[model samples]
Target: MSVDSDIISTLTQRAKQRPRRIILPEHGDERVLQAVCRLASNGAVVPVLLDAPTTDTATIPDNVEIFSRRSDAAQWRDRAAAELFARRAAKGTTAEQARASLDNPLLLAALLVGLGYVDGGVAGSVATTADVLRAGLHGVGLADDAHQVSSFFLMALADGRLLSYGDCGVIPDPDAEALADIAIATAAGHQRLTGAEPRVALLSFSTRGSAQHSKVDKVREAFDIVRRRQPSLRVDGELQFDAAFDPIVAQKKAPNSAVAGAANVFIFPDLDAGNIAYKITQRIGGAKALGPLLQGFARPWMDLSRGCSADDIADVAVIASLLGD
Candidate 1:
């Protein structure tokens, strides 16, 4: 079993109720175009393509809106530039620089979302992770309560259970405070997307007092911060993967913890661990990793795996449409 098919079906139905206008900056990419077709066909979103498909123009759907580079600038440049400057002026950005940056496809897509020309933006099939995240940070900005941008993968297990693995694709080496922030952001996102109460576990190489190291100490400290800051949040930490996910191991290891045998959200100690874990689950364990879905942004902007298929893009867009709700 993969992600509950019902969850995707439900989200697509919700998206159709109030279809979001989602801009695809890499419209020329075949995978992006295919995903756009899927989204348009389902009425899940109003697919806005930055540029017409170069090779598959004949396959483009009737409802898909394709904009040339010149046309996009002609239509939205003034508004996008003004919005960009307004958001960046405090950092001493000049109008000239703002206008120049708006010419960038990714930046313009994000700016369109920020300015409300569109509801969200999805790219990265043809862009690097850094490029995708930078556009979002500069254009959509960070959420008020969030310290910085972080990410989460919606891991759909073989047992048809959904879990969140966070800070997997961003924030290379977050400190304890940052880790706490990632956990909070991820937990909130998990609730919003899945409509399930999050039971968060901060994963480390040790379970409770089984090991002693600065890394273990960091996990403990972050766990404390999360609990103290959000007293109502159900969370635990210094848990190894086994203790976090397996009931038998949890009972033998960190017993009496609310999140111990049933963690729906896993916060990693670092990007290295988080990235490795998610990939291993997807490849070796046959889990469906729906994202590296971006979190902590004011407006919804998502990154795609460079290796993602068209189906992956469409699935991520459906989730992005539900973000910022």
Candidate 2:
């Protein structure tokens, strides 16, 4: 099936309400080009095309803004360079190297977002995850109190319901602390995207000690960490899938949890489970998976799958715009 139109419409409307400036680094990619056009045409965001005003400017749509290398030169020669140089210098980049790096679309786009010239950025259509991660960390930096960067997928159920499944793309394995961070971050994202209070569940194979394993202990510890750190947050843990999603099973397994059986956000114990679960929901259960969207960034920066389609890029752009709000 196709992506849920209702989900798209909701995000698109949210984006249009206060359209934010979004930088698209891979303007050379056909998918990026198509997606940017769609975003601009619908007024969801001001699509800023980095590296596009070069010789290939003729193909770009007028509604989109092209931020060429030449335009970035003014910034590179001024205050932006000083800040960018400071960020890169610790990694052994010299003043000259930092200046040159600013001309590259990825770094330049990140600089714009950092400098508050734009609200957020969307890239990775033609870049590696490493490249995107490096640029984002080096430039935009992490959100306050975030110990590590992680990711989540906004799963749109066949019934038009939305769920947040986290740490599926970035963290391969997390200790209690990182898992707590993922839970908190994903809960915030879940609330922001859906406008509903998040009911977060830290997932595991066991439900309230029904099964015994080190893995179950890890999830339980992470749940405790979340509860301690964010006491006001509605969260529960060590829940099996049925306990987390099925009310009858939840009553039997985790009767006291406010989050059980009504969880809109799920934090899986490891990447293996999170990744497998999201794919299973998408492929077998026929859900529309809209992310693997990075979280815990000071300014929003979405890293697309290299295999992403134009529609995927467009959807992510809208999601990025929503982050600005």
Candidate 3:
């Protein structure tokens, strides 16, 4: 399905009102360069290009600031190295290892973010998800309140509705507590990003007491934990996909559920289910999946799909900028 243009427009408008300085680190990729130009031209952000080739200056917009490791290395290297060493000192990372890591563009962009050189950053177009996330964790670190980092997709349906699917790209097998945290974080993120009230659904193979298994029990336990943690949040769980999505099915399967048939945030039981569900929704169901956005971090840093287009990178940069608000 095509993306909901209204969502992008709204986000773009919001970002333009307060253009953020966002770093794009994949300088070698044409797609990333294209996105940087778009962001600069639109005035939606101050796009910072890391290690961009000087030969490409004519193609690069004037508003885009080029960060060169060759000439600018002396200014940031020592400071970045010191910060990295401090953060990873417990892991036996030597000062030399920390200094050498600054050469990596992804880690350098993340360190710039940690050092407040930019509002946030977007990467992963030419990098693996593992590498992108590792840079974010080692450089930016997690929020004080966050126990673990998680990811979520901003799914824009063909019908012009936006939904959130969580832990699709991180945490392979979250237990009950972790699952609950994912739900809470995704719900909060949904509200923040979309300006819509969050109705969360903990997805399962069974709806209520229709069937029983350890997996079903885990969903149920997660539901309880979410309730205990955020009593004011509208949430229900142990619901089949149909029951959670279709009002007709919800009426028959879980009539009294607070979030049945109206959920905007969906928490999958594990990475396998979340990943498969999002791909199916994007491929067969014709929805546009805008993320795999990293959350629960101290600051905003995003992970783009390796196969993403220039438009996808531009849109994610806007989203990352807005998350900084």
Expressed as tens digits, the lDDT of each residue in 1-325 for candidate 3 is 2366777888899899899999999888889888998999999999998766546668987778877634766777678889999999899999999999888989988988888888999999999988988999988888776778899998988888899999898999999998998998899789978989999999999999899899999999999999999999999999988899999999999999998988889999999999999999999988878788899878899998899999999999999998885
Best by TM-score: 2
* lDDT by residue for model 1 (1-325), tens: 1255666787789778878888888977888988998998999888888777778588988888765544555767788888899989999999999999877999988988887878888999989999998899888888888899999988877877889999998899999999999999999988877789999999999998899999999999999999999999999998999999999999999989998989999999999999999999999987877778898888889998899899889988888888856
Error of 1 at 325 (Å): 1.3
Between prediction 1 and prediction 3, the one with superior lDDT is 3
Q: For candidate 2, write residues 1-325 as lDDT tens digits.
A: 3458878988999889899999898877888888887887899888887657445556677778766545564754465677788887888988888777777778878877887878999989899999998888877888887988899999999987899999899999999999999999999888888899999999998998989999899999999999999999999989998899999989999998888989999999999999999999999989988888899888899999899999889999889888774
Question: Which is the leading candidate under lDDT?
Answer: 3
List TM-scores for all candidates, in order: 0.90, 0.94, 0.92
Predictions ranked by TM-score, top down? 2, 3, 1
- Which regions of candidate 2 fall more than 4 Å away from where they truly are? 1-3, 53-56, 69-73
Candidate 1 RMSD to the correct structure: 2.6
